[model samples]
Target: MIQTGEKELKGIIPGSWHILVKFWPQIRQRKLLIGSSLFALLLETALGLLEPWPLKFIFDGVLLSRTDIYPDILGFARGLSPMWLLSLLAVSIVAIAALRSITAYLSTYGMALAAIQVLSEVRSNLYSHIQRLSLSFHQRFKSGDLIARVTYDIERLRLVTIKTALPFLANVVTIVGMVVVMFWLNWELALISIGIFPLFAITTTNIVGKIRKETNKHRTSEGAIADTTSETIGAIRVVQALSLHDMLEENFLIQNTKSLQEGVRSLKLATFLEGLVKVLMALVLALVVWRSSLLVLQKTLTPGDVLIFVNYLKTAFDPMRQISKQIGQIAKAIASGERAIDILDYEPHVRDLPGATKAHPFYGSVSFEKVSFSYDPSRQILHEVNFDVEPGQQIALVGPSGSGKSTLASLLLRLYDPTVGGILIDGRDIRSYKLDSLRQQISVVMQDSVLFAVSIRENITYGRLGATDAEVEHAARLANAHDFIMDLPQGYDTIVGERGGTLSGGQRQRIAIARAAIRHSPIVILDEPTTGLDGASEHAVNEALNRLTRGSTTFLISHNLRAVEGCDRILYIEKGEILERGTHPELMAQAGRYAHLYRLQNDTNEIEGVKHVLEA
Candidate 1:
């Protein structure tokens, strides 16, 4: 969906600002607050320039009495048109303070609104991009890490983008404004006050590079911790069953310690840079005061000029410190943007080739021709697999644990394409149909049926999303789950806890079958759907399976030959090939692998049945 070209990868880091510029279109929709932020910052800088000038008025008029002095200091200020100058200075100072507060509020509120609007869009886009990525990306990356990047890392960027950017922008404007005011006051004093600019520039340059590097690591480490915590929580059941809770806790603790170390390292660098800026301010102010004092004593400069330069020096330091603090936040935002972009750039391995047509509803006929596949190429899992099933026919696949029975189902679903051959439905290459449409015509009930955390009614509705409540209940009845479901106090409305943990294996499996049944597709697949059920439960599930697959082309994979006894045709698979094929009596007469497997199961069933009889 992203249509990423060559420059994109697993983590999308924009090499240039042009890639980032693409976000402005989405951002512009919230233009009012964004424009307000810029206007406020600019205005704040303009108002800040007036703050120091009022201090110059105070020094020249009320405090210093610039004209001349009397015998005593109090006598010096005693009467001489000082009232008019004093009154003007007082009003100006109060007015400047009020203006400064108003500008700060405007800039802060407007920028806060803009940051929230823009960052929300970024988070949503990142999530959509991750969801669109092919399974390969998910297989290789840790679930915890992706979760952290989406949740924790993105939030970090929010803090930097909204909390830091506004002040940093305003500070830049203030620095420029201070330079202008200094020049207006006295060009020579302005030059002297700013002589340390080159030194500060070099210092900021070296620190920005180092701070960016450390901040990236620090953010990544924090993401790792969040990832580990999520992974541990998701697998808490497995951890408890395996008695691995302590081991997982230890692993999480190690990651937390690493995050702590990185956080401290980042804070240490920030503190050092802040202190260096403060010391630079102090030295520059001392110089301006010393030089202006000499001029005043020589009757060339007034004391007001000296005081104004010292105040300007202080004003200038705020911008530099703001800049230093923001550099660290900028580093993390860049890292987050790059990470999200990488997933957005990936291409899925499977896609329609040129000139492919959308597949229509499949007829019952299905065939596999010379289909060979190897998820790992070093060892082929399916080799020259060939098979055909008639319309409304039932095909059984009997195999040992590692045989290619499951692989056959996967190929039919087109989860992966064959390396050397193709599968067809109604004489058309199955891949010709769009992926979703092809799967829609086939319904599968695997060995372990997955039940989402939802009500039984909702779970069954997953089969046919728009199916009516009556249809779902009817499907549940056909699957033989209606009785147990009604036995619960809440009936179909009861929530099936995570993976249907509250239900027995038979109940979950039966509900899963109901899901497939409600879809009423032309082809049905059952992969040992009743593997772990008890005898009575298995019989009920098999009865439901019969009802679900009635008149539908069906493929059944099972180790128990009894389950496949009614199949029109049976294929015995070994390793990756069909070692033998026939009906029940036909295979039994042959006395080959299928017969051997059948006899073994029959004998085991006889012994178990007799044992149960004796116990009864």
Candidate 2:
């Protein structure tokens, strides 16, 4: 079994860079999208830097009575008048805004499309991997929690990619551009402007770091809330029958309260961090302004220079504060990725070996050679058992509950492999066959015959996908389900509710028999097929089953002794061992455990029949 708990959970929650690196395969597939978005981002950043330049020209050239252009280092506006330069600068601002708007849209839309594509692939892969995992792995985890990981956690990655991941990258690029330009304007003033960066970094690290930690806790709590809700709703019938409304409500509320508390704590830290960044940026502006004013008076700097320095400082600090706010989301995406990746990383314990080949047609000659099994090693469920059955024989397995009857069927279907020894068909080990081909050759009608929420025709055809309409109706007729189905308003097209809840137990069982009959496999396993049914319903289902299992190697597992009379042979099993094997009359003649149990049930039924007669 794939083990998971605190240790595995902690192993998944990797750092931000780790998340990026781990998902690189998805990222690598969208190179065109990434390249387009990056180009647009470059355009937008370049335009943004030009945004403050127009104001610089207006300040130094128009307002200060200068004839040369503000940035005369290029000497491009040597012949232009002050008014002309001001008008040209105004035009430049409008053009910059228009270009920036177009590029911003492109970058934003492209990244969003890319992120959605990558996350969709991730979700698909997670679901596929989860479906292939062994039953033991699934039994170890709650279905609700796994659902949350597939839906909720994977969704977080989508939001983080578009909302947090892309934006964070853009901000880093903008910050770098601003730093290089600030130094070019005046190395001395630029140094003074960025002196508070160390302080800003320290404050953001302290608060956002805490927020990230709290956000991780918040995400986990939300998953718990999802799990609780799923469990409660899935079993709502039982909850209502037992009046467990208040108890479930209390449990759900506790998880919701914890999630709310963690969310609030993260918000508080993020808000405080944003405020601290603003305060520090204000102080940095004051120091830059004071020093720049002295340089202007001393003829060492232009007034436009001060404006550019101050504007760049604001631009740089603004993204710092934005980063502080998104720190929580970044942490959440990383945590979600960890949970999602856990599913994808799991290796199924029951997958076929590399050289395994498809199974040939089975002749139904099965041999269990010292087969031993256990779900848990300390408590063995099936001990060194051996048995053989010929083709077209109906063998009944009669045993007390938990005597390894169902386990034997599961091993035959390869839902799990045996712990020791091997099961063989036609003297070849079953493990040598490919999993799908082996399972497809055996038809199973479980106690609770599961039907999909689809058309009656579709449900029956599931046994053999793409079966013709005539073939489907033929199978239904063989299972004695055709008459009632044809009587319904929509006939074969009638839609069944989930698990066939709209139909009676007998109706569902007959449809399941029809599904199995359509497969026309050589081997059949009927596990308490008539269980939990009234006498009339059991009689009807048994009639259907008789037609379905004719001429097939059948294993009938039942506690009802009356149901086993037609079986060709009977095996009496107890405490993980088969103690007696014979036909019904032969077992009764031997007066073994099977005979004793059968006589006791016969006496009980006689008493129940007499009581029913008196009540009637």
Index of the highest-TM-score prediction: 2
Candidate 1's TM-score: 0.78
Cα lDDT computed for each candidate against the true fold: 0.79, 0.87
The true-versus-predicted C-alpha distance at residue 250 of model 1, in Å, is 12
Prediction 2 global C-alpha lDDT: 0.87
| CA-only RMSD, every prediction | 7.3, 4.8
The top-ranked prediction according to lDDT is: 2
lDDT per residue for candidate 1 within 242-357, as digits (tens), equals 99978878987888888788778778877887788888878887788888888889987777777767876787776775565465456556677566656556666666667677
| Candidate 1 Cα lDDT to native | 0.79
Candidate 1 error regions (>4 Å) = 1-25, 28-33, 58-115, 183-278, 295-308, 352-358, 602-616
TM-score of each predicted structure versus truth: 0.78, 0.88
